[model samples]
Target: MSDQQKRLQMALDAAHMSIWDSRIVDGQVIDGTVSWSARGAALLGLEEKALTQAFRDFLACVHADDRARVLDVLQDGVQRHGGYDIQYRVIWPDGSEHWLAARAQVFTGASGQPERTLGIIWDITERTRQEIMIAERKELAEVTLSSIGDAVITTDPHGKTRYLNRMAEQLTGWTSQLAQGLDIWDTMPLADEQTGATLEHVAVKCLHQRQTIGTSAHTNLVTRDGRQVAIEDSAAPIWSRDGEILGAVVVFRDVSHERKLSQQLSWQATHDHLTGLINRRHFEQLVAGALHTAKEQGHVHALLYLDLDQFKIINDTCGHSAGDLLLQLLAKLLQSQMRDSDILARLGGDELGVLLPHCPMEHARQVGEQLRQSIRDFHFAWDSRSYELGVSIGMVEINQDSKSLSELLIAADQACYLAKEQGRNRIHVYQEADVMLAQRRGEMLWIARLKEAFEQQYFRLYAMPIVHLREGLESHDEVLLRIRNSKGDLILPGAFIPAAERYDMMISIDRWVIRAVCAHIQSVRDSLAPVEALVEQRRRAPALYSINLSGMSLADSGLQDYITEQFVQYAIAPEQVCFEITETAVIANLPKAQVFMHHLKALGCRFSLDDFGAGFSSFGYLKALPVDYLKIDGVFVRDIATNAINRAMVKAINEVGHVMGLKTVAEYVEDEATLAIIRELGVDYAQGHAVGNLRPLVAGLD
Candidate 1:
């Protein structure tokens, strides 16, 4: 080569490129010299002095696997009378490998004879290494995606499935091969759990934004078999290196079990766990809504507040478990009697309220009566023992003119008080006057008063003697709750108990009663020795004193504990306590009361079914109460000696009580003739103004 040509070749060699020249004659290499730049020599593993080597020797530098194929290609190129460009791997002399890309051109003589071939070689080692590394990374990513437990799927820009991992196959029951190229929505339907509507909008949004969209809970997707499966999923847009939106990739996991757990929690929040009835909070909300609707639509709605009579006795004697069963059974009964539009809610314990939308006062009356009768006729049995359940219902009709929910509730509560006062197990409608008063107040003045009164000792106790009709002697005295107004006038319990109960103040009042009764008993024991022995002998430590228990108090789970604490603090024996619960309250929250009864009985406390055979007289409930006595309702005794029905009822009750090993007491007994008739009917005790009106604890002694 000339000196200038050699220098040019040396310059190109320093630039890390290669050059070659070859002479071709009839498809045979007449002569050839291949020179490579330093980098190219390093890539091909050839020394600079070996540039004149034979073509066959140069071919040996190519990886053995690629040698034959490369040589054949070169031979074919010569035969075709041209040059070639190709990329191949070369094992260098230093045992290192490189990628080389060679390009060549053929020069022919004017006579058309193939002449010299000149080729350029370049070191492509870095590019080749980078490409291999990219390929390896892609493979690893695919493998990792497939290995995930969550289903993974990728779709093309058109939303056609392009890839699916193993989890996708397992979850959707479709193999990747079958899923690929199919529209994603068609392959797996997505829906909202609550609305049951297709998630077409979300899918469209994902496609438009080229971003991921998914939920981790409360979502549903369809599988191949058309079964809906709840799942949580997320999708993200896939992009190419150039920032082109390729499609979207999504990850999903089945959460059917988690969804079920969430549903269960929701149920617990809104429903009573024991009886599966609407809970107090939920019931209040339902009533509030009903009132709003009724007022807005100018429609009348009835609110019925109910309590089971003598339920505590059933609970105390039969055990709380039995009481619970009875309550559950009663709930079923109440539900059956009401229209589908009616909402029945347990206001905690043995108290339940029903909202009757579109119902007028007349309809409310009919429904309440029917409900009372159903309970009256119902027979509840625990173990081998059978009891009759009775309910007292008070109802108030509300129209657009009604002030508020609180006013409506107060009216209904006042009616309930009237029901209990007139005789339990009956239904009472709110009087117009009472409703007007409540509406005028708009605000609940009673609630505020009760709260203040509870703190200020505005309450007092009165004693009514429970006399033995046969001996004409006082057996024990029943303690009656009375409130004194600011003017010092005595007010009956019926005027205030409903108010206290309506505002959830009954719990406080009950606690006060306990303290008051305890103090009264202590006073009687200190002042009257004969009365103390009489009470002690009757298991009424301070004298078999009777105290009323509200339906709310019966339902309070804390009631038994409160009673226990009172006894512990006051050093009072359970046997000295006689809890007087109306027949309606006992049967209303029979289950909860039953638990309280069992606990109280365990402490030697006794119970009485007060106002028995009042408005609601359930023979089954009577049989159920763990009572030592059944107090005949005052209504039955008002004309007991003259009225045949009253006489017959009194006879039946006395007979039933005797048969059940219980004492029968008649309230409202006023004359000797009535007392004589009661005794003839096997009545055990009598209490009334006729027996001599009840007096203050101190005055009674004088």
Candidate 2:
């Protein structure tokens, strides 16, 4: 080779390039006239001797996918009389593919036609591979952003929108194409969910702060179509590798359904399902607030407690569904007659409460009368039958005199009871002089005190000895319940039993007594001796004890299970205990009482018909009851020695009880004379001060 050719080859080799020379005529390469440097031949995986082939042979080395394009570019360059740069793939002898870039210039003859071409060719496979990888990654990111459920938007550091995904387009109603150059605040308008005021864009904050920014709670998105949607959103700044802020990405999701459901749940919590009125719990909260205002701000308010009269008749005659419908209708009627400021609530079954804020006593009375009149005029129809309904309303003033919410409610309830007692369809205002109302209020107070007694274990058992009049029978004790007041003063059962019975709390009290008595007896028996003594006592006969059960307890379905559980828990034998139920209780619910007595009797426990002959003194009920003893009423026994009629009554009861294969016990044997009379009358037992004064059963056991 010449020195000049060698120098040129050296420079091309240093640049990792190759040189080519070809002869072209009329925009076409001539055959057998193409030549290339050794480096160019080496790029095609061939030796320099391979260049002896024609131009068509060299063209054959180009990849099949790129051969036609390479020919077109060469022809265009020859016709234009200018240089062309082209990139194409080539296949080596081993069938491996590589990218090649070529730059060529066309030389023209005197006739102004292309003659020869000179080009530099180099391999670009690595650069091409890197570019393909980067493009694939970018396409994958786009697809991922478009497919996600949450809306995604990207903005420049200046807070200008750059891209929006498919979800963003759907949520904001602005496509990426249209929002590309707009401000992010305009592209995604936001507002306060509650106030309906426009909110600043979170992306703006993210850009300024260069950190993640979360939207305030309860934010709404104002769409392009002017629709508001509840949304939760967060924006985070995008940072370059060198720690410079490049842009921000905002992610958001629609929460409209969640917000609506939350609101619905809140509504349901405070409303009564049957009447669509505020429930008692929420109403009491409002009344409590009013009471606070009355004390602090001297605001006058009034409360009305209304109970539907003869509602039980409707419920029993037409079924509870009809009663429910009637209540719903009455609620709407009462609401229509009240002012917007007044709140009405369903206190409980067939009962409602109304709060009149900023109203005087006279106005409250007028409102109550109006409500009562409306109820009286209303008629409820069911299944082709119509019935007229009436309301008894009680009004109480709320002022500085109102001490508490509970007291106010109790006062109103008492007044309502007074209204019903006097006559139905009437309005009664609460006053301190209402004796009946006072008694009822006292009973209500007893309910609270009784509940507290149970919680604090204030109730204690006391027993009075029942002396056995017949021979060979051991004396037993009759258990009585007494309560300890807050001041540690003992209260007799007479003070609280009536209240408990009236409020349907007798079953709870009876259960408490049963559990306490069983525990006491088991503890006493256990303490008297160890396992051997207990076994000996069981072998002989366990000491008998009597516990009083109220009328309500007989009707309680769970009471039997409760008593059985207590007996098992304390390990007390059924034969060691006797249950005493009043004659009134047995007669009031004869079937339930019979079932209760029979169940316990079958379990080896004895039953006594207490206060016998006090109610329905006839002997007919004696045949039906499965009782082992009849405790003659204290009234009859208290005067048996002096009163002939009382003596005759006790004689008749004892004789009849004996005839029915039952024993007769006499109560209120306060003197020897009464005791002597009962003994003469063949009474099997006597109980009262004459037998023994009351003493703590627990103390005796201890």
Candidate 3:
């Protein structure tokens, strides 16, 4: 061997390299021999005799899977380039495998004629094992990045995204291919919750600092279509092996589901579960906010408090299921009529509240009127019953200079009471000079006392007889509700009704009246003959009983059902029950009132158009109301004997009622002169002082 060959041999032996030498002829290894250092022999499991043969024979010892690839590389170099230097595989006698890196060169004569080739080999098993492990780990990392549950986005130094995981795709609604090479902030727009500023406000700061940053807190992210998705995210600088900083990698999870869950829980804390509207708790918060804004902005807000009129009648007459249906329908109707900015909510059982932000006094009135009109226009049906729902709205525009939330709410509630007092299906706006705050306070106190009376059944029924003017005999009696205070003084309807309506205590009073009237009728079932023989008591046997229906009673579609059930429960004949409807109510919701009237008439009950000629006397209203009697307004009756217009109105109303098969009754008749004029005008019944003083008859039949 030459000096260089001797030196290379000594170095290979000391380095513990496995070595081989091959002689190539005719493009094949003609002869070869192997030698191994201790470690190299362990890698290959072979000694010198194994390699002392044609290299092709030695290659036959390679693992079947790797043999063909190694052979191809060797053959390609021998034929195409006339030389070979490649790393490949080999097999030991025990069928185990190891890698070998070989270098070879062709030996030729001066004329360049092909001759045998010489080559040397080194075992590369440990190096090959490390490479395989590294490749496997790289594959696992790729899989993990692709399949992670939370969205992962990695960006370049320019804030341009370069990687997106599967979760990121779904959350952002973008595929990796589409998201890659795009600026992250531009791709996924996000905004500040308070100011609606872009989240990029801090992005440039993060990029310049090269410092890892977890977003200080959760912020609002907007999806492609502007849906707010809450997210928790953090960013960190990526680096190269040489420590050169790359872009940031941001890891984020769509917390929208979490946010929605929290919002749901929060909403449940302050909202009505059934209607999904703000409840009283939320309402208090809203009113407080409105009052503050009104104070700060120098603008006034309005509170519209609404009570469904006659709602109890519906609830009592129908089942609670029907009542629930009616309430849902009413909620829908109210919501449809309000603006998106208006704060509308179901306060509680048949009551609703509306907060009109930045609303002026006139605008509040308009809104109140709009709600009243909408409710009066809504018609609903259940089974064989059908009716329009009506609302009595009380509105109080914030006196920015004077009122607090509580004061404003009370004022609005008072106006709502007045609306009901005016016979329902109406809107009453609080005016500057309406009532003193102290007076409302006193009225509230009175309502508290009235509630006590209702609970204790301290109310009494006083009868006003309706005497036939010509026949000089009493026929029916109107039952007026009177309350006895602790002082035992009889308080009139006008004195306590407004308070009752305000507190929603009228429903109890109405129930008491119904029960008392029913019990009284039962008590008087057997006194007809003796009462008839009394000279002044002729034709008083069929004294039909009448009790005024509060507006709240009418708003309840169930109230009619309750009354019917009560009548049945008490064995009271339908003919003995008379319902009085104010002219204003009938016209306020003509369609709905018509439906209610139809049901009442179906029960064989009678209807009276009370206070006729007091409102807008549309001929259409007269034609529509299913009234059995027309009660002339006291205004017309009081002056009928003197004022020509008053006389004309009374005569015309009497004619219309008579023409329509209804009896005409004159109200407030006080003297012989007024009585004579009404009789001459063809009025059928006379009431008021002129007819006869009212008194409770004996508990017997006439």
Show model 2 residue runs off by greater than 4 Å. Answer: 1-27, 30-61, 92-97, 109-113, 215-217, 400-411, 414-418, 421-424, 428-702
The deviation in Å at residue 555 for candidate 1 is 26
Assess the local accuracy of residue 550 in candidate 3 as a C-alpha lDDT between 0 and 100. Answer: 65
lDDT of 3: 0.73
Give the clash count for each candidate.
Answer: 35, 0, 37
Candidate maximizing TM-score:
2
lDDT value for model 1: 0.76
lDDT of 1 by residue, 383-469 (tens): 787888778788877777777878777777777766776778888888868665544453366776676677766777777898776
Considering lDDT, which of the candidate structures 1 and 3 is the better prediction for this target?
A: 1
Q: lDDT of candidate 2 vs native?
A: 0.85
The number of the candidate with the highest lDDT is 2
Each candidate structure's TM-score, on Cα atoms with residue i matched to residue i, is 0.55, 0.60, 0.51
lDDT of 2 by residue, 291-359 (tens): 999999999999999999878779656655577688889999999999999999998778899999999
**Residue 226, model 2, lDDT:** 93
